[model samples]
Target: MDKDTGKAFDFRLFKRLMRHTKPYRLTFYGVALAAILLSGFAVATGVIAGDIVNDAISPKDADKLLFLSLLMLAILFAQVLSQLGFNYYANWLGESIIKDVRISLFQKMLGFKMTYFDRSSIGLLVTRAVADMQRIGEIFSQGFFVIVADLLKMLTAAIAMLVLNWRMALIVFALLPIIMIATRLFQKAMKVAFIEVRAQVSNLNSFVQERITGMKIVQLFTREEIEKENFRGINEKHQNAWLKTVWYNSIFFPIAESVSSIAVALMVWFGVLQNVANVGSENTGIIVTFIFLIELLFRPLRQIADKFNTLQMGMVAANRVFKILDTESHIDDLGTVEKEDVKGDISFSDVRFGYIADEEVLHGISFDVKAGETVAIVGATGAGKSTIINLLSRFYEINSGMILVDDIDIKAYKLSSLRDKIAVVLQDVFLFADTIANNISLKNNEVSVADIEQAAKQIGVHEFISSLPGGYQYNVKERGTMLSSGQRQLIAFLRAYVSNPSILVLDEATSSVDTYSEQLIQKATEKITEGRTSIIIAHRLATIKKADKIIVMDAGKIVESGNHKELLKKGGYYSNLYEAQFMAEEVA
Candidate 1:
């Protein structure tokens, strides 16, 4: 919600946007050349019309009139062709530029740290990548090039008017200062209005996207009427933001038209007086020409204000998009190690970290997991158990201390190389709107159907999947909404298993599943963790009794570490926690 009340023309942002058009230089210049030609054609038409009145109509020469008519037709045809070239090439260049920009934006988002996504809205990002991109395209397709053509026409018309009759041109130019002042005010007012319009557009998109995504919650609580009222308020604000722009246009255009009419009136009035006083040609061509000349001069002046609005909006969008591109949120992947295989031995030594600076979530946490060992971490909520997984995966960097994999500092390995060896499944699983096989393979075609089937079978979910209507090809819909919560967790398990990682981390992976799914998941867990190092984060203490070690945490500190029987005998923090939090489940 940063309000950028920038100047009417942001030269820096303009230059940045222009850089994107560099690759399409040939097409860009071709469109500019067409704009120049269009201006020439427009001027020629007006000149020819003046000639028709004097050279063809005055003498009543039929043959001459016919020739003049054909000539006018020819000029009209050329004007049409020039316009076609200008319109088509401008749009083609614009679309090409936005296509490149969208790709870059998407790539930047992909490289950003998880913290960036945590603090940003998905809908706002979508608006930047999609709707704002189209506005940037408008700068070329309808705003910048069109304004250039109009300005050229106006300039040529002014020169022609002065050359033909200076006195009348002076009279017409008298009213320009009035219109110019209004237009200057219009540009400033519209810039502010359009910026608000774009902001409201982002707000509306964010609200609607969140509401639709969580429609079930509204329905479940029977709060439909309240949500509807909330939506109406947002929609009203969006409408009002647009109406402000419309109001500016409303005040500007009528003043522009009225001033144009005054210019036309003064031209005709002066022309008649000059003809009556015997100071000009009796043929009436000059007077007739002034009428055409006046329109050519002032019509573009009128339209230019509107086009400038488009240009300003485009610059605003470019500024926002470039801000994201320039953000320094990407994790530094400077590590030179490129090992394709890692031994799954992880160690955290005096690691202190936080999602925010100066507020540590893991206070000097330290632990070690040997290769092929299974360790379970049990803790109260907010005890920093999940932060351990985030640190191990390097989704967020630690503030102080070292995390090592196979005795080498984890930061010394290439990010992809380090992550390739580890896999994590969270309690709340996410699936894309794609086929079951595609979800399991993450759209990696190299993981074949046979491989997916084999992994699913080994993980004990193949029978459940085969029972669905499309089996392996079943569409899970958005976020796997078509599947039950336990089913979604099972899918997540299968997905992780197919990656064949040397290290696996399950964060509350079995917390939401039913009895049957839990049994199947437990079996799948045994198969996947047979030889690989595994870390299981569980709230249910019974789930991890067989783990080689149990680490109990409280308030970001590890209070105990031992075998299940040993920890029970200690009767310290772990014993008390088990009695209060897990004893009822054990009894049931």
Candidate 2:
């Protein structure tokens, strides 16, 4: 699913992921200190046991035994405190780092070019931003630090064994290599399995999200059975990927348990022989301590496999998340100019653009709209009407030539400032699950309730809004489902009108509405386009007959330019298109 899927761990990705921790270095240092304390406390527990057996319990010295018992209890207390601190701070650091990472990822995506979003999957991105970030957090909270602490305990235990009885320790250490070999194989296999798991998770999420968003289409076309089968196949792949990890775990853990068991048995066998041969009586305490030491050493070796799996999964997620972070799809905002006000004079001088490289959608098109003038563009479906709107807002960069506003290149103005001066009403209006006033003013503090009401009044839709249950406070719900298409368009128009923009664009704004709504929209249009630079792109030529100029587009080129009366007199592209489409609508 991604490069480095074969790697059990990636140090590069790990380092990059850790960089987000710099801001919380104090918490990181505190967690590190706690981990070291926990390891030390763990080792002391075993040594204290030996002291109790040899110095107190063995000789039946009641006083010494009581003191050692209290000492061991105190060590237990310290260990618990250290563990508490370790778990808290490590998890705190993790949550903090992921919070910053998530925000940075969102900010980066916010600046991406429209072309980047045009082809990207929404569900896949949601996975990267939400699910993958938690995996990265687990790397710190439960993965890396836990593995290090466990290994530390093991190392300290190993040294204590060597000091107590070297021969028995060596015998126990012989089986260590066998466990290591198995663990290494397990890590590699698990890494590959986790990669597949993540890939399938993303695929399933994308499929379900698309199906849910377009559930209407599926039901309308009667495709539910087919979709269910597709989901089952994707879900099975997800399950099988996890089952592979389970299979590897099943084979590996039992082998590890057996080797450790044999190691413990060998230590006892050797210790018993030394005592029977009249060796040092001190071997009694040493034998008991070795029991604790062996558990410490081998148990982490077994448990490390689990933590390493988390580490591996986190690295895989980090790799995928970093790819998005490293993508260079942002539209350049290098322009130093910021305008307080803009004149709405617009000109596209031989402008050309393609959503994809070398596949031009608008080929060297040219047009001009002077301040306070209205221009209409009539085109067939794919004649590049929307592409012009995208270019003017700097959502997509022009491939060649210049787009000027007030005779200055659009690129010369700061992107935000340029967009602030324009408002667009598209054929499809999108509203959030927010109040109607919010959808209109869009939470701009400058536009108040009074302002929205006044603008709605000016656009002649105030009466429609006031008729609703809560008037401007009405919750339109997601995509404005509570409202009709005509009502949504009225909201869109009032939204655009309230902006008081220097330039305005209406893209098929009046299509797909009832006659009464059309009448209302026509009145709104007449008032809103009064003194603003307006660009109207429509298929219905009847809507723009009074426009000062009309440009006809076909297959990415401007075929005719004139007023409606002049074009009809010339019997050109606009006249022929108008005749055909108008006649068809009339017949219908």
Query: Root-mean-square deviation of each candidate, in angstroms?
Result: 1.4, 1.4
What root-mean-square deviation over C-alphas does model 2 reach?
1.4
Say what the RMSD of model 1 is.
Answer: 1.4
In candidate 1, what are the lDDT values of residues 1-588, reduced to their tens digit?
A: 436574788887888888988888999899999988888888777777878888888877788889888988998998899899889989998899999999999999999999999999899999999999999999999899999999999898888888888888898888889888998899888888888888899989999999899998989999899989998998999999999999999999999999889988887788788778988663278777788888888889888999999988888888788889999998899999977768789899999999998888988988999999999999999999999999999999999999999999988999999898899999999999999999889988789999999999887899999999999999999999999988998888989999999999999999977899899889988988889999999998888989999999988889899978999999998898778867686677
The Cα local distance difference test for each model comes to: 0.89, 0.91
How do the residues 68-162 of candidate 2 rate in per-residue lDDT, one tens digit apiece?
89988999999999999999888888888889989989999999998788889999999999999999999999998999999999999988888
Q: What is the lDDT of residue 235 in candidate 2?
A: 97
User: All candidates' TM-scores?
Assistant: 0.97, 0.98
Q: Indicate the TM-score of model 1.
A: 0.97
